[model samples]
Target: MSALQVGLAVAGGLLLGGVIAWETWNARRRAPRQPVPERRPPAPEEGERVEPGVASALPTADDERLEPGFDTAPGALSPLGPVPAPEKRPRLDALIDVIAPIALDGRVVSGDAALAALPATRRVGSKPFAVEGRNVLTEEWEFPIAGQRYDALQAGVQLANRTGPLNEIEYSEYVMKAQHFADALGGAPEFPDMLHEVARARELDEFAATHDAQLSFTLRARLTAWSPGFVHQQAARLGFTAGAIPGRMVLPAEEPGLPPVLGLVFDPRAALSEDPEQSAINSLALSLDVPQVHRNARPFGRLRDVAFALAEVMDGEITDDTGQPLRTEMIDKIGQDLAQLYDTLDAHDLAAGSPQARRLFS
Candidate 1:
């Protein structure tokens, strides 16, 4: 072969080999094989269930135990229901229980206005009376303290006698009488060796004459010292009224040519032994001829009247039973009424000590 022919023939052979290699490469790329999926384990034989235990998975009685007859379902109530209803509370009696502290066969006492005007006495002291259904009893002074409650009212009276415009002789007589009363009853620890300052006064014919005729001088013995502060005022409000003595040896304060020494006589035993609050409230109702409203009753015109009456009595502005200057020592009674009124207002959320009430004294 010639040199040129040999070179051309070599080139053609390389070209043909290249074309055949390209076709083979293209066919291999287009027809490449895919990977096989993973195989799972073989299924179990028919009716061949695997048993891990012999009924050991079931819950025992202890697992779901509950209270007797108790329902475990959602929102279920227990079989043990509430107890049966208790007996109803008894109703309050109007005649017997309505009177509370005041009762028949009771004595009525009295005191001065300034002596009875302390508001603290009303708050700190006992109710002096309660309306437990209807049976009233005025002997509640020893309620908070064993029989020492009278001392508070007596102290109040003494304070009024000392600071107020009451005369020295009268004040002294009042204190002495109180001391004697306490002594007769056995003196308190505070007033041990207490003497009856009013002994001499009581011995005076005038004292006997002016004192309650139904009660002997010995009854005065039962009477503790009640100047104003030293005793409960409730006793007085429902007890005594200002007026001429009906048939006593003494004349009334309004009586013409009456002795100045014979001040008004206060007899606490005159009224029924009832709660002074209820007594005052009832008496106030009677005084105004109004109905007895509950303590929570509103529109306090009746209460206002009671307050005004009380304030007038306290300020010595209230006329006596006979339309004369109020000479009877009845501030104790007024204070009792006031305490009830205050309690009533408080219970009802009423305004306390209304303007008319204040103006009555002013």
Candidate 2:
């Protein structure tokens, strides 16, 4: 029993104690995880609600409500169940019921009757230069043309009185009247009212006379009596500048007093040729064989169609200061197309006094 024996005995006792503690720790570590929650039995139909783990398996508040505009209740059938083949609306009947009228000027003119039967072109006075068809009555515009503040309706009436079956004479009278009005109003001051009307008239007359055709239609009347200032105002609204329009004037006759009158007509035609919207008007006129002062106006209508289509294409990309896109391309294309179309039209001799001619001439 020396010190070595005593140390070995103490070490054995310590090792045995450590083994017992290790066994206790291992037994605690091996205890089973807590048992998973068991599902409770579903409540009776008339009792408390049961929760579902998956949302799809449970009925929602909306599912229980009845579908609007349907006969079946919700939950009983699909909420959107074969959407009762949309009760078709009586479209034709509705159209007939709420049918609209063809409004001209301030009054309703036609409904179901053929437009041809209705006196579309009517002589206001006994004179041949009468308002035909659906000439819209406009508020009288006062302007200086020759040397007076003249109104187109008044001038038209005067021309009718002065000329009997003399369309040229009547037209001349219009020029004289406009000239007199212009002179009287101080020779092109702030606003020139007869710019479009007089200008268009002179051009049409000259062009028609050259082509051996007669100018006819509400358009003719509108031009003969259009207020240049009013036209400029309208142009401004459409994003064009309101001022003296730049143009190349082409006279109808080589008379002393005729140059200014012809210039009036020529300028508008050139200006209109540059406008995208008005370009189509020219084409439509050609297509319909509508008489125009300037033969050049014929191709403008088609150009306008192209311009409008181009504008539609650009949609939101190009816009003005107020979010309006400058239709520069459309306008340019219109001028180019009109030039080409004019060349083609010019090549083919416009039949003089044919059925196409007679309708306008006669």
Top lDDT hit: 2
lDDT of 2 by residue, 1-362 (tens): 99999999999999999999999977554431222233555665986676666422112234322122221111122232221111121111110011111222233222122222223332323332211122224333221122222122212321111112224444444345333433432332121233443344444445444433221111121111222333333222222232355422121211222111111121355345544222212111111222222332222332233223222221212232243343657545645644554344345332321222222333
Superposition-based RMSD of candidate 2 using all C-alpha atoms, in angstroms: 33.2
Highest-scoring model, TM-score: 2
Model 2: weakest 10-residue lDDT segment is: 90-99
Give one clash count per candidate, in the order shown.
64, 43
TM-score of each: 0.16, 0.17
Whole-model alpha-carbon lDDT for candidate 1? 0.28
List model 1 lDDT by residue over 79-156, tens digit each.
Answer: 333212212321222211111122212322222221232233321111111111111245433222222223223321
lDDT of 2 at 10: 96
